[model samples]
Target chain A: MTTTSTAPLGDITGSEAALRGFLAGLPGVDQVGAEARAAMLASRSVKTSAKSYAVDLAISMIDLTTLEGADTAGKVRALAAKALRPDPSDPGCPSVAAVCVYPDLAGTARAALGNSTGHSRVQVASVATAFPSGRASLETKLRDTAEAVAAGADEIDMVIDRGAFLSGHEGRVLDEIVAVKQACRGPGAGRGGEVHLKVILETGELGTYDNVRRASWLAMLAGADFIKTSTGKVQPAATLPVTLVMLEAVRDFRAATGRQVGVKAAGGIRASKDAVRYLVMVNEVTGGDWLDPRWFRFGASGLLNDLLLQRQKLATGHYSGPDHVTLD
Target chain B: MTADRPGDRLTVRKTFKLYIGGAFPRSESGRSFVVRDAEGRFWANAAQASRKDARDAVVAARTAQPGWAARAPYLRGQVLYRVAEVLEGRKAQFAAEVGRGEGLAAPRAEEVVDAAIDRWVWYAGWADKVGQVLGGANPVAGPYFNLSTPEPTGVVAVVAPQESSLLGLVSVVAPVVATGNTVVVIASERVPLPAVTLAEVLATSDVPGGVVNLLTGRVAEIAPWLASHLDVDALDLTGAGGADSDEPTGQLAGELEAAAAENLKRVRRPPVVPEDWTADPGMDRLRWTLEIKTVWHPVGV
Candidate 1:
């Protein structure tokens, strides 16, 4: 059966008018009915259970702000140590997906992870283009992206110039994005050396749901492998509402263009519950494909401990404070 | 089947104009564009609103916000409901216009027009009640009593939807005003005639001046101005989709969102599908309209 392209307005008019008239006559401030209340409660429970299971069963970490001043060698060694040491008792203690560090530290991370015995699982990602505050020139940004990828960074996180964007310089932003993506393309040794580019929206600075949606689409159209929320430098980074808005944008973009792009809610996400909420949003908004560590990674410094605590709570039927969990 | 019966036959047409401060006016630029039927017949010449026209509309919406928002909720609902009444009276004209422009059957066009008008009436009732539903006292662990209520976010710049021209424009404008915010709407570029007629209805109805202003022009030309306009408090780009492959709408949305950030202007992205119009209103509208107002009174009193 073919779907009708045109709907006759007259046919729907009677129903529309009756509905409108009824709505018009009714009191504006009526209480929500019991059915709706019950449905809301059930949905809330479903959402919470869905989120908890997602966080407990499968969720990975992407530690971006960890290798602050560390050199390439130190960062790689750190990543190798983390990747090789998964807890034996906890089935949920999967190794992290990647270790995100500064561009200069990409080679060290790559070599450490690649050469370590029984530790080729972790990928090395690099932040390029005057990250945290993307105020650099396009040429320098492009160069930064190329240098990082050439140095064995599998993924590149580039920040959009919030100042330029706010100034209504859309063409410039698009051009920068295109140039960086072009720089990251190439052929690797056995497989393609094509680096996944995560466009950092720095949503805290963008300030509104509308802007977040717009930026999410723009990045996706400009060839973003993943759309990231924040650089984690500023306050109010990575909010649930903001992530919800971005995920909606991804879903909309996919529906519009048939392209499935990933989302990364980085920065200010420190708790297992917060991670669970992000996971819930991703699952609900984009579905199960995004539930994996390969697609979704929490850019966090203190998130692992919280995840461990939640896991412990689930196992022992008792909640434990931060003191009981081990530190990295 | 009746021969020589002129009474059985019908003709439909529309006239498009710019709506400003509750008045229907031709574009200040004195430019007009012809909208044609699917058979390539001339239907109407719509006002080609200019940058100056957009800025002027913004001025009108800004000037009228405080008073319109201050009006009693029930009174505001009554006025908005009156708009629906006027629209219902002219439903035939809207149906005919849409039928010719969209190449749809008369009956189909009538349904679209009726749905659009009814959408206005629905939101009109929401004018007063949306506040009570979306906002309330926050459960804070503090001594200070805090109540959050919905408030107009001031003048908004809106880009009406392209495909469902009249319905899309009404769907956006009604919600913005239902919560007391004034708007400057940029009508659909390809089919703008119905928007102007709706503006006429608003003028005749008791809609406060500048509560809603309509612009008819190239969205690309006018959108940047509205997005970058420093005075505008929020933007709704629900109609930025074009036939072009580049999707300039997304780029425009980003630019405007970033620009709005300077003053923390609320922004609502364009809906991907027309169904989004009838779907549950996202938090975007609520977030934009609701404000955290902390009322203080002497506890002793």
Candidate 2:
């Protein structure tokens, strides 16, 4: 079931008390069970035609990311072009879903994709709300999202304030996500349609599986169109168990509330095999409904090249080398 | 001696495992094959390394290459020399393995063992001196001073000579590592006992764990993966085209050389004829595993 439009998740965010109670009342994730299940699913092999199909799906679902301090406009433009034509040699290769960058580079990425949009072109996703570390004030964070949205960013990835959440101020975190979500609405409604809001939990810093689950529900309840695992700036980013917990949260959230939210696993997902494992996890955990690029994505840079390499290996019946793929 | 000892005690047999990252690990595939001496007597079980094992060894070698290459040439020399010393101490065991695995007479096996140890020492001596011989300053007409130095070419995948297990394995491996290149060596399929024994010596010596990874399996099964691996910088096809190889020579070597062409890997084609291990292995292999880097610096007033 694709989400045609965002619907508010009841009145859970009506007040600080309601939001806290709802998040706290939400079931605690079983750490051991989650980890064991994640490990077990990771062993499931998707091969041959299934592997080829999974590679294409994974490539199309990638939010080709470049969020480095050293990233220049030219670099973002090149990355955008690379995203559009992943394998320049293979015209049949599908473009990635989006090109993720900093707020300032959203226009560059959008322009680099040329005139194509919707069906033919890649979407531009920008990491806003003082990304990596959501340490800025609410005003600045909202400004960050608005600027990116104004810069032609079709999607806004905003990092949650882990400090506020971990410090027992869940309401403040919810308010901040709501503010960022509102800012994702661009200067006026329907100008370029609704800018998708991806709430990044930076789950690495969230501490435990239970916290990851709570954070997932909190973002979803606060109108997050997508719940992301990490900012790729912290250690232990986007672990399988954490992702499993997030995926379970989304499944339950969708069932409970009638609204479907996407899941994005970022950081440390490099190998094609790992990407396939994530795909398998998606298929098994949430069923085939979330298998589409609209529902699941990988926020990565090196992963695209690996998927390309594996795709080539499958096509050529021999192992391929890094030389065949472009360097990110 | 205890006359009352309960029957004869059961002698313990060492489980030969693949040496990777300085640790003995069974094949990731959890497969082991029976190893029989050349006389057709069952000897022991050697790990039947899979492509995954070969890939892991490449990762280990790639990880160790930088630190091993960055070591002072004198330090690398001392480490390799120490390997020779360790091999000398374990010569009896290695010679026994060689005698059985290669169907050689005890004396001939001992001679092969001696030659292998000597070859290691020879390469150890070259570790410090090879750089001086291979690198030097170039006279330039411009104001810039140009100098060239030979650097290790990262990870090397070596197929050890299938016939001459000990001497041939050492011959190919020593030259590659002598120039600071870390190697993932596929030992002779028919005679892998001595290669595993040499891995023991490498483990005990000051040589880093990943500097020399030994894999005991079919060259056809492992060499293709290593040759095409993006991380592996070179391939030595010595064992692929050996005289006693199970696969037809040139077929395997040709395939590997072509796969290596994907990344333009520095490949040393196998010898046209089976090599005489006792003969000196000249600078060919050392040069094969090294890249010449030239640098220019402005001459200051």
Write down the lDDT of every candidate, Cα atoms only: 0.71, 0.88
lDDT string, candidate 2, B48-143, tens digits: 999889877987888898899999999999999999999999989998999999999999999999999999999999999887899989999999
Clashes of 2: 0
A204-304: candidate 1 lDDT, tens digit per residue: 89866556665776677677989999988888788776776666666665665667888888888876656765665676666887777666777876776
Best by DockQ: 2
Q: lDDT per residue, candidate 2, A1-328, as tens digits?
A: 2121223447778888877877777667777888899999999978899999999999999999999999999999899889999999999999999999999999899899875646766899999999878899888888888888888899999999999999999999988888888887758325458999999999888888879888998899889999999999898888888888888888888777878999999999999899999999998899999999999999999999989988987887666656678877
lDDT top scorer? 2
Compared with the true structure, the alpha-carbon lDDT of candidate 1 equals: 0.71
DockQ of each: 0.01, 0.43
Score candidate 2 by lDDT: 0.88
Which stretches in model 1 have alpha-carbon errors above 4 Å?
A1-328, B1-15, B242-249, B273-287, B296-298
